[model samples]
Target: MPETTIKGPVLVTGGTGFLGSHMVDALLEQGVAVRCLVRKTSNLRWLPEDKIELAYGEITDRASLDRAMVGIKSVVHSAAITMTEDHDEYYRVNETGTKDLVKAAMNHAPDLDRFLLVSSLTAAGPTSRDYARTEEDREEPTSLYGKSKLAGERALQKINPPFDWTIVRPGAIYGPRDPALMKLYGMVEKGSVVRVRGPSQLVSLIHVSDLVEGLIEALTNPIAVGKLYHQAHPEPITWDDVADYCAEALGKRTTKISVPRTLLPAVAKGAGLWASINRRQNPLAKDRLDDLLQ
Candidate 1:
């Protein structure tokens, strides 16, 4: 198939983030003019120094979004916070921020061909079976992050004078630049015993490259419009197996140690408390203990 000509520049929010940076690279490689909207405080080391446009804006500010949308025909709404102590912060950035972008896209880029929202597999909640999740499943997010994303998805659907919208819910995305996965890799590299909170629980995952490909495909494919898609690498690996993969990647043996499920709550609770007291954010909050066991 001939490549779809992106008639105008492409706008990428959260362009300094892990997945967003990859998406920016992918768009640039496709010979598409990329415009990145990022906060003033965001680190731009991952982004190229040339060949793209930059717009300083935060998701919370609706007024500045119009500047980013100018001359952009495709909007990849990747701006979102994954972890936060306040649930309201998640809603503000993930839901309200998304709504603002969609509205801005409609007003500024009236002829926009696509608006892609990068979401997460957590939107589907924790599944009992090991099978890969599909787009048809009901969204029952188990965490504030997931819940806020689902809310964003719902808000996007209600946009007036609608543009083509595709929601891609990716599983645990892992790659070189991923902060969370890198921590696991670091632990394994240090020969630390990796504890498996739930040894038998299976979770889906995708490489950052694969996910970027999916996002680009969704942008041009009419089938993706007004649809939600779940993405993985066609395989689901357990948490224990993930540690083993990291060990193998690092040329080390897996230090598999099973932590009892009963103790996970206490551990998570303590971690949460420590994070709270330190005014730090912990992704592994108490609510995650149950999902960890699955």
Candidate 2:
């Protein structure tokens, strides 16, 4: 497919999120006009206000999505809840919300050129260190979040929309302003890391800049239409690799300790119980504990 002229703004969902905010920056830096679909309650601290339009909306609402899709040339759906004890919420937001957005774009944006979905490697589960997961592999999602992401993909595929579309699944994205890695960086600054010596699975990592580049590529490249790509550094890394780099970056001597696997179940249960009592998310919920090992 030859590239069409970009005649309208690119609408981005979750523009205030860490990854979404980076996407916003990349779009603006490249001279594309951006319109963000944002809720009134969303934080704009990570988002820049200049040269951008804000369209108040929610993914689950058709009317709001309709307003956001007006004069939109393309859409980048990047919103999803990462932590939730209720499995239904994942399906509601990731899967159902995507269906609504795709429908709105199809119904509202007559000249839409691209519709890119920023999924995650968790949707494909994991592989041994010897074999990196590829787009050709059959998906075997091991977590609720992964299943919801896969569901989102399936929801769009079911529509069979008449437009250029692609999917990019990224792994463990880390960079400046990302809070997920900050805790580990803080621990490294204090001179220690907790290592779980168990199954020792392979994991992939990508920088925010590289992943944002991949996102733009998937939109502009004709070869990406109806295709799936896994974007990551060309290698798999282990926890030891992460620890050493963190320590090196912080210039601190760090102690690494091996923790017993038996200790996790109790911790997970205790955390789950406390969360249920307080209506808060457990950092060590069973799924999260499984995530730490798997």
Candidate 3:
């Protein structure tokens, strides 16, 4: 396929974040001008300060979104709250914020080529290796995060913008700059790995690099417009498989300790309570636990 010509700079929301930062790097390597939409307080450690233009703003703020959309050819919307104690925050940022962004683009970026949404597999709900999911399947999100993302997808469809729009739903993503997966690797490095006893849990994951390439294609490819795509490895891997890989990579002999499934809710609840009290995210929140066990 011939390369799609992008005229103006591509505007990326959440460019300072893990996935977004990787996207920025890829775009820069392709010699496309990049602009990042970021909050005033967002950390710039991951972003290439000297390379990309920074557009200061929050996605929820219409005015800021408008300012960011000016003269931009395409948008990569990767800004959404992944973990928060408040359930409303998911809708506020993911659903409503997305709606606001598309509205801004429609009003401001008359020449916009495309708007690409970085969504999650959770939005499509649970699936097994036996029954893989397809875009044709009904989205039955199991968590608030998933529901919000699905809602975000709907928001784009509802607006029916003249410009192209695509949604890429990636499964459990793990790579550099992902602190959550790092914790598991850390545990494995310590010579002990924890697992939930019962049925083997399966997950589809794609490396950040591969996912980024798909995202860029979804953004630039005219055929992908108005379509939703699932991006992940073809085969699913179990949590045990992941732990074993981590152990082997670190050259460490690790012990696998299984925890009772029945006790997880309590532990998750405690973690949620503790995180809530301390104004932090609960990595093992009940909603996330539901996703794991589902």
lDDT of 2 by residue, 6-61 (tens): 33589999899999999999888778899999999888998888779999988877
Clashing pairs in 3: none
**lDDT over C-alpha atoms for residue 13 of model 3:** 94
lDDT of 3 at 38: 91
Q: lDDT tens digits, residues 120-164, model 1?
A: 888777766645557887767777777888888888887644777
Give lDDT: candidate 3, residue 81: 89
**TM-score list, all predictions:** 0.90, 0.92, 0.96
Winner by TM-score between candidate 3 and candidate 1: 3
Clashing residue pairs in all predictions, respectively, total: 1, 0, 0
Question: Which candidate number has the best TM-score?
Answer: 3
* TM-score of candidate 1 against the unseen true structure: 0.90
The lDDT per prediction is 0.81, 0.85, 0.88
In terms of lDDT, the poorest run of 10 residues in model 2 is: 1-10
lDDT of 3 by residue, 206-227 (tens): 9998999898778677788789
Model 2 C-alpha RMSD vs. true structure (Å) is 2.2
Candidate 3 Cα misplacement greater than 4 A, ranges: none
Error of 2 at 197 (Å): 2.8
Error in Å for residue 103 of model 1: 0.8
